[model samples]
Target chain A: MRQFFGWLSLVVLMVFLVIGALFIMRPFGEPPSVMDDYIIDNAQEEAASNNVVAAVLFDYRGFDTLGEATVLFAAVTGALLVLRASHKKEET
Target chain B: MSKIVRTVANQLILFVVIFGLYVIIQGHVTPGGGFQGGAIIASGAVLLIVASGSQEIKTWLRERRLSVVESSGALLFILLAFAGIGTVFFFNFLVGSRLFGGIPSVGPNPGDVWTGGVIPLMNLGVGLKVMAGLSAVVLALALFSGGEELEE
Candidate 1:
């Protein structure tokens, strides 16, 4: 049937895509870009932290972290608001 | 739901809390950070809730208290970020100072506790915020659902 061939072709295309992605994958423990080198070299001196990852997250990218916190707060606020509104309506 | 689960959870909660605190405190030097540690801590609370039921522990898991904790944590983090406004938004102000100012040797060594100026404090603040937020949300959802599966 046409539907059967359609699903079969879809599966074949996905398999090819997966194989291609695997072939092009970057090697483990080796960075693909230049930014990793710079962050590693300067993290301790710039942020005074031994953990380069933490240094980058907290100091170099503090704005991103701040925005993340804001988003979380907003989510919690929204959840409470929706839940409370329903609870009030039920009470009435 | 059972005696064994409640007993095990009661005993393990302390260790989970301690580990989470350790991760948060040593975040500047360790691989773990505020968000990871906070999730770990909140997981402990969730284990307790799952075993004991939220309704039973409703007194301790007060929504108002959790909201206050989350708000205070947010305030603390924002204040800490603003503290560095003298130079920049998130400057490492404690660097090179006598307090929390110890610098580490370059390249791959065991990190110290006293280093990482505002990072550790920020970790604590963010950790508190996340822990309170997640646990509060879970508790509220559980309470809303009446803490059980209902018949349709």
Candidate 2:
């Protein structure tokens, strides 16, 4: 039945996720640090800010922030557009 | 909402605005930043909107004005990024100069307010953008649900 297959799939996915988290994934807070180490060591001196996270967001990885802003702009534009259309019909 | 709620919301918004600005301005030395601070401010706006109906709120805040603020914030953010394009995109060009350029001693020490180069400016821009954008969205939703429309 459909219900049986759905349950089977759910169990299968859960088993795989648990195995991946327990065995395959590295321990938490110990990511590959080739780039992180450099950022941590030199961010204050180079970026002239005590907050390394801010330096990373505004200076080091700023292009990502730009993209994020663009995404927000687009989303807001779309929502406004959709909401405006319905109201226009009522006004006319 | 009741009379007491409206009066309390009116009085509390001032402190909310102050705390949000503090979070945004000190972003370079603290845990909070533009987006978080902006969200906090927008929450304050939401509180006001809830206390006052959409029809009452529309007399002061219109979609057109909020859109203008959002656009200005976006423009400022991009302008600050483009200012440093001579050396590289998003370069810390003002690192050693006088304006927000004092490099802090590299270790555990007291935080300095004027040491983030362009980051604080960028934070301000982003904070403005997010605050206006979110407030506009919530206002629009509230208006639509109440059978009202934002002014052109």
Per-prediction TM-score, please? 0.82, 0.84
Residue runs of model 2 more than 4 Å from their true location after superposition: A1-31, B147-152
The stretch of ten residues in a row with the least summed lDDT in candidate 2 chain B is B143-152
- In candidate 1, list every pair of residues with a backbone clash: none
Tens-place lDDT digits, model 2, residues A1-92: 99999999999999999988899766788876579999998998889888999999999999999998899888777777778887777678
Candidate 2 per-residue lDDT over residues B75-125, each given as its tens digit? 999999999999999987888688775789988889988998999999999
Off by over 4 Å in 1: A1-36, B147-152
> How much DockQ does model 1 earn?
0.48
Please give, for residues B1-152, the per-residue lDDT of candidate 1 as tens digits.
77888899999999999999999999988789899999999999889888888777797678679889999999998898899999999877887668886788887787788899889999999999999988888877777653343222
User: So what's the TM-score on candidate 1?
Assistant: 0.82
